[model samples]
Each structure stands twice: as C-alpha cells, then as structure tokens.
Target: MRTNALSTLSFWNTPRIGVARMQSDMAQANQEIVTGRYADVGLALGSRTGLAVGLRQKSAELAALRDSNNAASLRLGTSQAVLKQIQDGADATLTALTGVPEDKRAGVLKDMAANRLGTLTALLNTSAGGQYVFGGTRTAAAPMSTYATSPASPAKTAVDAAFRAAFGLSQDSAGVSAITEGDMAAFLDGPAFQGLFAEASWGTTWSAAGTAPLTNQISLSETVETSASANAPALRKLAMAYVMASELGSANLSAAAQGVLTTRVAGLLGEASKGLITLQADLGRSQAAIAAANTRLESQASLLDAQIMDMEGVDRAEAKTRVDRLSTQVQISYALTAQLRQLSLVNYL
Candidate 1:
C-alpha cells in the first residue's frame, strides 16, 4: 500500500505548530505575570514614599505655624504688661492729685517720680528675644539715657539740655514742661505708641522735656519733672499741685482753683485709664486672630497630608494577594509549557 505522506506530514506539522504556539503564548503569559508582580511592588514603594514625604511636609508646616503663634502671643503679652504699667502710673498720679495735703505733696511728687521713672525704664528697655521692644528700629540702644547733675541738685540740666536739643523744647526751673496728662494719654494712643507694640519704627524724636523735636515724635521717659523748670504737662500739673499743697499745708486752696485742678487731673487720669483698657482689648483681639490663623494653617496642612496619603499609601493586603495570584499563574504557565515541549507525534500514534 502507498504511504499517506501528506496525512503524516499534516499530523506532525499541525500538532508541532500548535505546541510551539502554546509555548510562545505561555512564555508571554509568564512574562506578563512577572511584569504585573513587579508593577505592584513598584506602586507600593511609590505609595509609601509619597506618604512619608507628605507627613514630613505637614510636620514642617505645623512647626512654622506654631512658631508664628508663639511670636504673636509674646508680643501681645508684652503690650499688656506695658499697658498695665502705664495704668498704674496714671493711677498714682491721680491719687497724688486728689485731696493730698501740701506738706505731704513732696512725698507724693517723689513717689510719682519713682513711678514715672520705673515705667519709662520699663517701656524704653522693653525686650523680646534679646531685641528691644520700644527702641523702634534702633533696638540696640536704650530709649532713655542716663542723666545726672553735679552737687546732687534736684535739677536735671543735662537731661533738660538733651531733651531741648533732641525735641526742641525749653525747660522750667524743675526741668519740667507744659505737657498735660491728657496729651500724654493721646500720645500713647497715637501711631508711635502702636509702633512700639508692633516692633515698627517711630516717626520722630522726643525729649525728657516732653517736647517733640520733630513734627511727629514718639518716646517715653520716667523723669516727667525735676527741680529744674521744663514744661512737661504731666510734670507741670503735678508740680503746681504740690506747690499749692505745700504753701497751703493744713490750709485749703481757693475752692475755685481746687475745683478746676481737681477736675483737670481727674479728667486726664480717666482718659489715660480708658486708653489702657482699649489697648488691652486690642491686644487680646490680636492674640485671638493669630491663634485662629495658626489653627487654620494646621488644619490645612493635615488635610493636605490626608490627601497625599490617599494618593500614595499602599494597600499591603491587596498587594500580597496580587503577588500570590501572579506566582500561581507563572507556575501554571511553566508547567504547561514544559508538558507541551515533551509531547511527540510517535507517542500520539
């Protein structure tokens, strides 16, 4: 019988082709599985890195916000402290002006001087983080310089001369000037006083004589008045009262003058006291605003972190599951490809 060569060829070639194709498909499937596994690992790593980066960024932002809040709070605290001192000084002056005997006026004046000096020192020498608070842009220097006279006279000629030159004002025998308590209160309310709290520059210069050498000026000192004649309003008023009290002693002043001076002193004190209250309120508000801003910034940073986590964080359990599935698929493909490679036409026949 004639051999069906074509049939044999068909049988051998067809199965061989099928097996080779299957092997190629299996190889591709195996490669795909490995690629998928590596992709999963890469994605997981990327997610982890992203999360870490986000957390670090948020931490830095929060720290900065906290620092800003702390700084604002410190400023508010200092302002409040200074305001309290001013209030106390004003109160002392008020007390001295009211119903104190002339003979006792000297002691009251001395006390007032002490209070003024103390407040001035406190204001001028105010500091934060080693920087002067009230020295304006010139933070390195004390706002009030030391001034003394020879023979220990009550007069402060050196201070008066400096004040006149710095502020263009003349002094009376007591080195006091005609500045009123009301004027002082107004001065504190002005931009110059605000600048002190804000750590900004003041516009002009002031003298111990309570005169502004420049058109606009802002400064403070303890020596409102001395034995030398300068026309400081607060000091002059105090001195006048002291003199009246001393001259009258047990004797009372003319009711009219007494009434006028008393009313004037009381009005000035009331105005100054009110200003303190207002400034304190402002400081409280500023502190609150800063705290609010800090809170907002922190919240925003946290939200950003959460968003970053969502974008980058890995699902560990899912990744493990995918790895396992890909591993099994690879094993199956390898086993099937090996089986196909072993198949032969002789075995089938």
Candidate 2:
C-alpha cells in the first residue's frame, strides 16, 4: 500500500501565495474604483489600445486648437475696440475741422491732431499677452512709430525731407505763405508726396509690421488671420492725415493753402473711416467663424471623450464588488495561514 504525505512547509506556503494574489487583485480593483478607469489601459484594451491612444492624441490636439482660438478671439476683440476708438477720433476731428471757424481751424485742429496722433500711435503699439497686437506677423516689436522730431523719428524725417525737396523750402519757412493751392494739391496728391504712405515707404519708416498678418488655427480644418498690420492702408492714411494736419506748419499757411490741406485731410480721414469699418466687419466675420469652429470642436471632444471612456474607463460598481470579494478572500486566506502556522508538535503531544 502506498501512503501520500503532505509537507507542512507546502501547506504553509499555499495560502500565503493565495493571499498575496488576492491582495494584488484587491489593490487593482480599488484603483479601478477610485479612478473610474482600467488599471492598465493597454492590458485592458489589448489590440484596440492603439485606437484609444490615437483618439486621446487627437483630443489633446483639439484642446490645444481651442485654447489658441480663444487667445486669437481675445486679440481680435481688442483690436476691434482700438479700431473703434481710432474711427471715433477721426470722425471727431473731421467734425471739429468742418465746424470750427476758419481763423481758429489751424491752431485748434493742429493741437487736436497732434494729440490724437500720439494716442493712435500708442493704440497701434498696444500689446496683449506680451505680444504687440497690431504688429501683423511681427508681434515681438511695436508696429507703429511715434510722430516726433527730437529722437529723429524716421517717419517725421522722411516727411520733412519730402516737403523740403518738393517745395525747396522748410515747412515752417515764410515761403510756405507763397505756396499756391495748386502746388499744395499737387504735392499732397502726386507720387512724390503720396509715396510716403505707400507700402514700401511705410514699412521702411512708420511700421515694423509684416505685410502678412498673424494667422491662427481655429480648428483642425480652419485657419484665419487674427491680427492687423499698422501699415494697412486705412491706418497709413489716418497717420498721414494726422501728420499733414499737425506737422505741415498748417497754422502759418495762407488761408487758401490751409483750405487745400484741410480738404485733403478730410478726404483721407473719411476714406480711413470707411476702410476701418470694413476691417471691423472682416474681423467680426472671423470672430463668428472661430465661434462656430469652437462649437464643432466641443461636440467632437464630447464624442471622443465617450469613445475613450468606452475603451479605458471601468464600471465603478463592478470594480467595487470585485474589491469586496477580494477583501473577503484575502481575509480568509490570512486566517487559514495563521492557523496553519500555529499547528505545532506540542499541540499533538
């Protein structure tokens, strides 16, 4: 007859092993319950893990796009506000020019235009989030230069030189009184003088902005220009109007010359106001487009969240149940192991 012998050491090790495995299962279940996700996404998703990873990556990209779009929207809104201020200033100046008596026009309009030009320069050089908002693609630096002479402003110097070359006399010279309305008109409208606000000359002196505005990716499929350049025709015209009204020695000009200068300034201001309104409309459209893109992004994000949850998220109730059962099994295994350890030869004696 053959007899089977049970090893006490093997008996002691068996329940200890079972308890260790049950504790590990309990820890896994507890984690799943706490996090509401599978403890190991790859292990749970297996062959479809790549799909989950791709979806999560795409979702992250969408989130990034939405964040950037929000920033672009803010910048656009700020730009629009500044544009409104500039338009208002232009309108107000035109009103003052037309309404003020002829004798008072030069002094009042000159002082007002100078102050407004400074304000406009400050506005164009406005910064948001450490970036100059009106700098087109050149956001790191101020887009507009101050209209001043002390620091030898490039724009001021250029205008002064152009005036001297055209009339063979400085702006403040008494010879300005001799300039016929025809000469003033020719200089203001001709290539020689109008060229100062042309794209090349404006870029060379008045503006540091690029011709192309800054663009933003509002969504996976959509991109929009989110900035304006100081060198845009509307802004250039406004600056030119201010410079002519304030810096051309308008106060000393004969009444006939003043009339020509004021008429040109009024025309430029009107054109600038119209162009600025058009710009605002374009930005308004961009804002609408960005808002629509964000809506689509939110919907896509929600769907992706649902799909990711299906792949990686766990059932909290089921995980809690598993934790409870594992806890009981581990407790029983521990008790049995303790009882086995207490089984001594002295107890059998």
Candidate 3:
C-alpha cells in the first residue's frame, strides 16, 4: 500500500468538486422552477414518458379540431345570413307581383327582378378566407356567371334560344301581344323551356359549383356539411323566375298573358323561398353540432392536460425551496474558496 500526504492542491480540489456539484443542482432546480416541468422529462417520468407524449398529442389534435370548427362556423353562418336575404327578396317580389296593376306589373317587376338577380349573383359568389362559400367543393372561383350580355353569357344565350324555339319570335318582338295566356302557360310548362332551369342545364351554363357541398369533421365521430351549392334547386328556380321577368317580353304581352307569367313566377319564387328556409335550418343544425362538438373537445383536452400534468409537472413551491437552499450553499462555497485562496503561512504567523 502506498501512502500519499495531503497537500494544498488536495485541499483546493475537494471544495472545487463540492461547489461544482452544488452549482449543477442549482441549475436543475432553477430550470424546474421556471418551466414548471422536469428539466429532463424522459428521465423524470422514465417508463411513463410515452403516456405523457400520447396525451400531449391528443391535446394537439383537439386544438386542431377546434380550429376547423371555427372555420366551418364562419362559412355556415355567412351562408345562412345570405340565404335569408335571398328568401326575403323572393317573398317581397311575390308581394310586388300581385299588388301591381297589370299595365305596370311587367316594367316594375322587370326592373326589380333585374336588380334582385344582380344582387343574387353577387351574393352567390360570396367568399370567406379567400374561398368561395357557395361554390360547394369548388372553392377556387366564383360560382355564378354574370348575367351580362356584352360577353354573351351561356345562360343568357340559352334563354334566348329557348324563347325563340317556343314562339318563332324574339322575346322583345312587338308580335309578343299575339301570345295568349294559354300559349304562355303552355310555353312555361313545356319541357324545352323548363329544361333551362333543370339541374343539368344550370350546371352547364349558370354555375361553376360542384354538386357535392363541402364538409368538415368537427370530432372523431361527427362530420357535417359546411357549404351550400349555388346549383341547389332553390337557387336555380330563383334565378329562372328572375330571368323570366327580366329577360322575357313580359312588358309587351297582353294583360291576361302577363297575369299568367306573374302567377307562374310567383309560384316558382314561393318554392324557392321554402327551399331557402330549409337550407338555413340545415345549416343551423350543423352550427349546433359544431358548438356541441367544441364543448366535448374542450372537456377532453382538460382531462388530457390534467393527466399529463400529473405525470410531468413540477411542484413550484418545492423547486423554489430547493433552489434557495442550493443558492445559499453555492454562496458559502464561493466564500470558502476565496478564504482558501487568501491563506498563507505569513497570515498564520
């Protein structure tokens, strides 16, 4: 066995090691205090770390679902408001159609219909967050075609062709007076004319929207439609009713013929109003579902947070106590090191 004598180097080295350890403890405790979590999560929880990771992942998923629900609510809420405006317009048009004298009905209703149709087109093209809300799944562009004839819209051209094929005369022709009420009714009821408002024709000429509406997943089990299509029967019928009053020669027809047109227009508009109401109701239900799903998501997130906290959370009071004690110990170690450095044989003498 070899015996080694203690020297100044040995005395200095022992305190240095103790101070280093104290400093390391202080750093870890301070970290735990500031973060309210273990400085090393995997080391603290060991085998339970995987459970904490899974809970955090589930919490993140819940947050994402809430965000999606918010977006869907925006689109659905805006769509419902717009549909109400359209329904109000149709109802008002019906009233105006019946109240006006036959002599003034065609001109007044035509101007009203034209204005209403322009407004309707713009509303149907509404967008939210750069996405077209009424375009169903086709969110990239405006769903409705402009009714302007300067560019010769496909819808306007189709309507003109239908009118010509029915009466052998243009809609604005002076010979429209010879079109009797029965003849006008026959033309309206005819397949060739009614086909203009059919789903296929509307898709080809009037709308750029997809047949399928957009949907969102509010939760793991709940997915609901978040959009309304411009090509819905209500919208098509509403557009056709407006086109007839605005485009066809209602202003040039006989009183009885105008009456026939007014009655038919009123009926179509009424149906459209009902359909619009139904659409609003459907969206209202979806809104309710999203709201309910959000409540559930919040509850689930809260439970996950609690479980994760139990596994990984630091005790703030205990960490603070440890940090204060380590700080005192570190200060004492520094003082002792300074004292040791100042020691000399002359001071002892």
Candidate 4:
C-alpha cells in the first residue's frame, strides 16, 4: 500500500508532459500543411535521406549548368550581332568602291576604307560585360594590335615590314606601282602574306583559343566552341583591304595600278563575303550545341525535382488531415491539463 501512493505533483507533471507532446505534434503538422513539406525531413525519410541528398546535389548542378548556359547564350548573341554589323559594313564599302568609276576608285572613295578600318578594328576589339569578345581565352586584353606602329600593337610593326617587302614600298612611302594582278596574287598567296595575317606571328594573342577556337563548358560532361576564333578571316581580309586603299590612295596610281589593286582586292572582298556565310553557320552550330545542353539539363532537373519531392515533400491533403487531427487532440489535451490543474482538496470544501 505504501508503494502505490502517487503525489499530486507527479500526477500534474505526467499530464503536463502529454500536453507538451501534443502541442509539438500540432505545430509540426501545421507547419507541414503550410509548407507542403515535412517538418522533420530527416526523420520522415530516415533511411532515404541519402536519396534526397543526391537529388538535391543534382538539382544544384543543373542550376549551375543553367547559369552557364545563360551566360554563353548572351555572349554568343552579342558576338553574332556584331559580326553581322561588320559583314554589312564590308558589303557597303565594297559596293561604294565598285559603284564609282575606275578613275576615281582609289583616291575618290578612300574615306570609306578609312572609316571601315576604324569600325572593323573596333569590332575586333569588341567587349561584352568587361570581357573582350574577340580575345578568345585571353579576354582581358585586345586580341589584335591597333593599326598604328605604336607600342599598343606589335602586329602593325610586322605588317608594315611585310608591306614593304611585298610592294617594295613602305606603308607610308607615297610610291605608286604597276604592281600587277599576278604580282599581288603571288605575294598575297605566299608565306610572307601568311606571316603577316597569321595570328601566330602576332607574338601575343588575347584569345584563350589561340591557334584554336574558344571552348565553353555548358554542362558537366560536355563543351562547345563558343564564339568564332577571335578575329575572323573576313575581318582580316577587310583589314588588308582597308590598309591597301588608304596606302595606295595616298600615292600616285596608274590605270594598270588601279586595275591590279582593285581586281585583287575585289576578289579578296568577294571571297571574304562568301566565307562569312559559312562562318555564320558554324557559329550557329555552337549555339545549337549550347541549346542542346540546356535542354538536357532541364530534363535532368525535372527528374531530380520529382525524386526530391518524393523524399522531402508532403502530400497537401494528407498534411491538412493530420493538422486537423492534431489540432483536436491538442485541444483535448489542453482541457485535460486544465481539469488536472483544477483538482484540489480545497475544491471539495
């Protein structure tokens, strides 16, 4: 009989514990209903937490891929727009040069070449979001030198020398030539011309894709050539055209000189123009690759999301039912707790 006696404090404490437990369950069910997710995710999926964690990691990776794809898309878009502008400018300049009579072709329309030189160079030195678009991997600095022989561009020094060797005249030495079509073609097609135009001879390249095209990692296992290898064939050919117009126009020109220079340059312009169409398609392919990567990432993300939801998310209707049940039980517990508190020997008096 002595062992069976229970204290009032013990009785009150036992019911109080039950009340606290009910309130905690009520709060958890309410939270699950509001969030559409388990309040205790780890407890709810104790053995399956590994699967949930893996899915979350995959989702994070897909998100990163999306961010990279967006950046690549924007950069490629800017590059495409600027490239079109350069092509159009070249077309207009070539048209103007051709439209004029042969007599005034060189000196008369020289300004067009000069203007184009400035614009095309500006295009080559283009930047997007503080990164040099033409620099390939070397995005911090300009990919090509300025047209001047100043320290800003080392290529100009080599170019000037190459011109002197090819035409037997300095870039600035106002000397006219009967330099024939065959002569121009031979020189342009030779190693000397290659030396002048080749990106390798420029000593330093701003493009990270130096000697190769730029490569971008759009996904975990895949990479694509992003923009065209900095400073395209058309742009270089245009530069040569610009330099010839400005230099040759400065000197006296015979009919033969005009014919030869114009013919050779006209061919270069034509080829450059034709080449651009192909180049544009190549760039489009790179963009298409990025698009493909994004599509794959999106699909993967959907799968991972579903898996994660299965592990961590709650059923909305079921959570609501649980909340209602817990709410009633908590109310009953509160009433019991109150009744227990009211019980006292003095109440009987």
Clashes of each: 30, 0, 0, 7
Which pairs of residues collide in candidate 3?
A: none
Looking at model 2, residue 104 earns an lDDT score of 68
Worst 10-residue lDDT window, candidate 3: 6-15
- Report RMSD (Å) for each prediction in the order shown: 15.7, 2.5, 2.7, 3.9
Name the regions of candidate 1 deviating beyond 4 angstroms.
Answer: 1-63, 102-107, 136-141, 146-267, 312-349
- Which pairs clash in the backbone of model 4? 135-207, 136-207, 136-208, 137-207, 137-208, 138-207, 138-208
**CA shift of 143, model 4, Å:** 3.0
Candidate 2: global Cα-lDDT?
A: 0.89
Which segments of candidate 3 are over 4 A away from where they belong?
1-28, 336-349
Q: Score every model by TM-score.
A: 0.45, 0.90, 0.89, 0.79
Per residue, candidate 3 scores C-alpha lDDT tens digits across 295-326 of 99999989988888899899999999998998
Overall lDDT per candidate, in order of appearance: 0.45, 0.89, 0.89, 0.72
> After TM-score superposition, what is the CA distance of residue 198 in candidate 2 from its true location, in Å?
0.8
Worst 10 residues of 1 by lDDT: 213-222
